[model samples]
Target chain A: MVEVQALSKSYVGRTVLDGVSLSAPQGAIFGVIGPRGAGKTTLLKILATLVAPTAGDAFVAGASVVSEPLRVRRQVGYLPNDFGVYPDQTCAEYVEFFAACYGVPARERAALAADLLQLVDLYHRKDTPADRLTPAMRYRLGIARVLAHDPRVLLLDELTAGLDPRARVEARELLKELSSMGKTILLTAPNLAEVQDLCTHAAILHAGQITQAGPFDEVLATTPPYRTIAVKFLGDVRLAMNLIKAANGVVDVQPFNEPASPSDALAGVTLLKELRVTFDGAYADASVLLRSLMHSGVQVVSFAEEN
Target chain B: MRAPHLKLPALELSPIFAKEMAGRMRSARAYMVLTVYLAIVSGLSVLLYMVSFLGSPRTVSGSGAVGTVVFYFLVGMQVLLASFVAPAFTAGAISLERENKTFDVLRVTLLTPAQIVWAKLISALGFTLLLLFATLPLFSLAFLLGGVEPRELIIALCVVFASALMYALLALYISARSRTTVGATLSTYAIVLGVVIGIPLAALIGSSTVSLALAPTSGSSSPLADLFDTLLTLAISLSPISAIAASQRFFSATGELWTFTPSFTGSGLALTLPSPFLILTGVYLIASVILYMLTVRRVARIEQQ
Candidate 1:
């Protein structure tokens, strides 16, 4: 329900988002992951119709962000990274106020606000002032406010940043529930790991460019099919390496070392050099290599995935 | 075939207007501000009553000169105070949205730019009117005392409201331009100073210089002098204080609230123009509409890019 084409943004003399493009299909939980200053927020703002791109355009729910911002706004709900609560306004009042802004009839706002508050699990805090709610609760109320108009697409910037682990999990679950309801969600995060478990599709941005963009599994699976296995050998490292090189699916082997301790060197200790094997295979082939190393009488101290 | 455009239904009260009114009414600060405003006006009225009537019994005639003095003083204060209060209420209207990061949310709403502007204007003006109405008894004292007429009271009210709107729109315009609440408030006060104090002073200086320079030759009859005097009068009329003073002067001279025809024959453009109250009201309302449109344009630009 959201599509961006070669979107670029610049502020003064500095370029923030450079020719970035991505799309989110209907009901998909798409995430944009990048470090700070990677233009993630800028990209999201452009799609949200809050910021205009210097070049290119974005469309949400068939509305061009540049030409039909009001229409885009009608179909999309944007929760900015720094979303704040109005002081002295209760949760229900805040949601009702937004519902009113979206032109929800006065008679319907109460029930709508109630339903939205329930969706965000903030029904209990309905009467509480928005500022009195905890940060996570306030964030949830912001979500509830955005959904007050029942938008089809949600453009959230840093939707989970600064949340406690439990709140984060709850927010993820709520997003999942909403996505299941066919609300297309596009969000930005600081790291892939933050959204890896929740997002079906994600784009990794670096230095204002999309470095990698695809389905989660597809992107992760395309990372060279190379696994570095670190093995600590106590004796006959050469034989172990030679046998691993001859093993099935073994691509390459190299000796790796952890920096030696001065105390160990001074104590005449002969530290075992680490062996790193580049293996391209499934679990069965890795098991076979381990068995062969064991049968070869090579004493192995440790074995682990390098990364 | 061209598709027909469908417009959204306009709400009688904007959601922003309702929200602002609700927020303002709920805050203790609003009540405290009102209390302080009432207290000051009450104190001034009582002091003026005592000084005008009690200090001199001979001046207490059936003519109610004391009432006139008190009325003028109270209306002057109302105009001046509303100027300050209106800006204080509205200068931060938009900038506070930016501070709280809600401007984008507001823009994306179905509320049109004009509706948002009206919301800010109406809410601020509503509070200002509330404060003005709270002093109704004091205003009634002027009428009860007999120098102030119902007609003059109504005219004074119209002028007060128009000036309040002018100041509020000024602040909203500044608010739309500023990124911070403090910056907008400060800038609004600066503009307020220019309109309330600076403009009248400049007009006085300009007119006096023109009069003094021509004093030796023409003594206020030359066309150049007439033109300068007319321009100065009109410029001075732009300030509410000057407008109220001129209105009071006209009321005292003609014993009428408004005079559409010139009371005296003169060869100056100023003499043919409308009363200062009418002129100032028209100028302020027109300027306010222009500024409101400019604010809406700025907001639309922000939304588009």
Candidate 2:
């Protein structure tokens, strides 16, 4: 579980994060989506207790990241997007070192290292130096490092930003596996499509504020869901508009008006004037309305959705 | 609250110190540095002994003389070594956390700022001391001539010990302040070298001018003369070479126990300066401690707000 209240951070004269508040419950997959410079990384750093916020408070897994950072750290595992490895250290050695730093005992570190490596699918690369690994391998090892201590919550900053398509898919799939284990995952990224199907919940951050957040479908539903269809009437325009208005999903209609056209040309000129219409439900509504209008009396020319 | 299965009472400091040592040990550069240091101490001792041998029967300035040269070489080596290694060690000790983007991970661990600072110091100094120990055989070669006084040896060890600690702490402070190892290393070397090198040069040059100006005066101690004597004595102890030389001169004359007090017999020893070295050591030590505390505070503040 995580809670942030009025969290703000600034460097010099510029504000990076301004009064951003958020909360994630146990086992919830919370996603923070934003464009560049939206303070997504800054917010994650504060939550991970790596960087301090200039003002406000945060708690991670019942421990205050501001006041009880050590406790919070023990409870949370953070995988920074750019967290790197010592080139000379083997994957196993790297994980072992972190385990030691996290206060895992000497006796338990070896096996724990193996287990974590296995979890990240880097078990075969256990003896391989960390720097020699590919970008995807490096990211997987970074994840292994975070899970070495079996933390309660995971804060993944840009978990799939720079990876190629295949690696990105792998990361997403790995996250899905961890989430199934009831891990409270809080991840940040800009690719909505990648996370759209993967994340159960997401927050859209624009200009350093949580503009909209919740289930992606719920947020999309909150916005006006309408299918806009463009139609060129081959026959009488007035007659076509009347027929479309009578269909099941024909909510609204606006006639296409040309600039600097004579009144007579604009009137009764159904060959070129395109009539746009809106429909609720699937895109089939627009097609169904268009066919019904054509079947009645008006000759339909061309019709397409407003992509 | 307890950390499960922690055997080391100072386990918080253990990981940092061990990793510090491991990193340095695995580097060819670290070995190269140690080799250079060993060569300098051995070569300097040989050079100094040759010079002393050429100076007459008085060249055998007794056992204390041996201690003098040993510590003189050690002082120079410690300064050079501290400049080189302290920067590398302390600079990366904290800044590299930022470099690897693991600063957050380290900060979030169940280790407080004080623990982090202490671990950093141990990490830096522990490795430095290991290299120093590796060259102790060369040090003992100076002791072989047998004129070194036990008290002088004790004082030398104490000064080197305190000096190493102070240097380590100072570098850690600089490391904490900077975000990169390069910046921290350069700043640490400059600041520490300035403190350790600057003060002694000022004292030596200042005292020499005063001594030359007062050379015409006779045997009586003017009030001002006594003050200069006290200041000069303090300066000698503050300095590694001067302290060794003064102690050597004192032992070559009267075999009295060395303490902070003075036996104002100028017939045996020309002067006393260990007290001043001790003063400077105290000042530097205090400064180092204050700097380390400030570093810890900076880290804690970064974590808090």
Candidate 3:
């Protein structure tokens, strides 16, 4: 439903998106993961037809964003990361206004607004002023506003950027429901884990380039099959290193000593130590390794896989 | 293959206009502004009427002069009010959209650039026309008192409306170019003041210099002098205040509200130009169309920036 071909965008002389390309099939939830200022928002804006790419073009729902922007607009519902609400407008009025903007008939707007508000779980607050809504509620209202047109493609930029954990979970569920409705959704996030659980197709964008792209498992398969396990402990560093080095599936161990502080010296306590172990093993083997470390009497503060 | 069927889009009220009007009219501040505007216009009209007719014997013939005084005063007041009010409504029209971060949302919709600009222009102009027309009863009162002609009232109202539109478009143009509402507003007012006050002041100085230069050669006609006269007429016609004054002068002299024929005097040195009201109307209409186009273009190119 969405295809981008070598799209490049530059501001003045600074290139923000450099020859990036990606594609998502119909009804796929595609997540573009990148850190802040990694040109993720620029990519979305180009696809949304709000910004013209300096080179190449993007297409949404088979319409070229450059040559046929209006048609593309008709096929895409874009929710910007930062948007403002009309100060005196109700949530229902806000949705209805966007419906009107999308050329929805006046007679059908009320029902449409009601249905959309219900979809975003904002039906109870339909009459409340939109600006007065909580941030999470407002974010949901934005989703409702974008869906007002019922476009086939949704370009949501950082949909869960500032949401609480519960709200983020709700947003993920909402995206899943939207995907189930056969709507192709393209969303952006600052980390892979935020979207890894929800996205069927994922792309990792960094420094204005796509580093990885495809189905979730295929993208992961392209990377080395090694997990870095971080262990923080307040025990003998040498013994912990030797024990981890001798453990099965342990490939490398790098120890980091926490700087000894005057307070620690006064308390007569051993300094804290952290070890990053690169392990090439199955999930079961990793758990067995942790159990052995615990049984060996080493005080483990944290044991977790990093990426 | 046969040509594809093509049809022009139907005319309808823009959704942006509808939304803006809904928000504007739903606010208590809108009604408060209307009430305050009506109160001031009404009080001023009553005060002007009393100042003209009070402490004097009520004479049937003197009512005409009183009506004339009151009518001009009210018209001038309306012009001044429009100059002040139009910018307040429109100087932030586009900049506020940027400030509120809604510009991209609107752009991404099916609303075309022209539609958005026209919607904004019409919404602001709609409220200004509301304010201008709210004083109609007062205008009718002046007409009933006898000296004000129907044509004069109509012409005066047209001038007020034109001036209001000019001011609104000026502010909107600045708004489209400015990044902040405060900057757009301050720049709009500065330019408006320059047009309203500075142009007339410059015309005065130019007229005096021309008069002084011509005093020595008062008998001969020169193209330079004629050009100066034409430019002076254009400048005076550009300012609403002087446009009103010129209209009054033309009416007092020719007793006509509009004319196409330009007259000359003083061996072609003194220029009795066409009706200043007509000139002002023509200039404003053309300039407004140009400004509208430029604003639309600016807005259309915003995403590129």
RMSD of each: 12.0, 13.8, 9.8
> Which sections of candidate 3 miss by over 4 Å?
A223-307, B1-12, B55-61, B209-213, B216-230, B260-272
**CAPRI level of candidate 1:** incorrect
Worst 10 residues of 3 chain B by lDDT: B1-10
* DockQ (CA atoms), all models: 0.19, 0.20, 0.21
lDDT of 1 by residue, A1-307 (tens): 8888899888888888899899889999998876567888888878777788889888888899889988987888889878777886899999888888877777777888888888898899899989898778988998888887778899888877667657889999989998998889999876555576789888877788987888977755653345768888778777887888788876556565544578868864456767767666788998888888888898777777765
What's the best-to-worst order under DockQ?
Answer: 3, 2, 1
Please write out the lDDT profile of model 2 over residues A151-265, one tens digit for every residue. 8789998877557667878988888888887788999865354366677777766667776767767655553445567787666777888887777766556565443247756
Q: Pick by lDDT: which candidate is best? A: 3
* Winning model by DockQ: 3
DockQ winner, 2 or 3: 3
- What C-alpha lDDT values do all the predictions have? 0.80, 0.72, 0.82
lDDT measured at residue B243 in model 3 versus the true structure, 0 to 100? 82
Per-residue lDDT tens digits for candidate 3, residues A1-307, read 8999999988886888999999999999999876567899989998888788999988888899999998998889899988999887999999988887888777777888888888889999999999999778999999888887788899999878657557878888888998998899999976555576899998988789998999977876774455678898877888888888788877567654444568887875446678877676788878887888888988888998887
- Tell me the interface RMSD of every candidate, in Å: 7.6, 5.1, 7.9
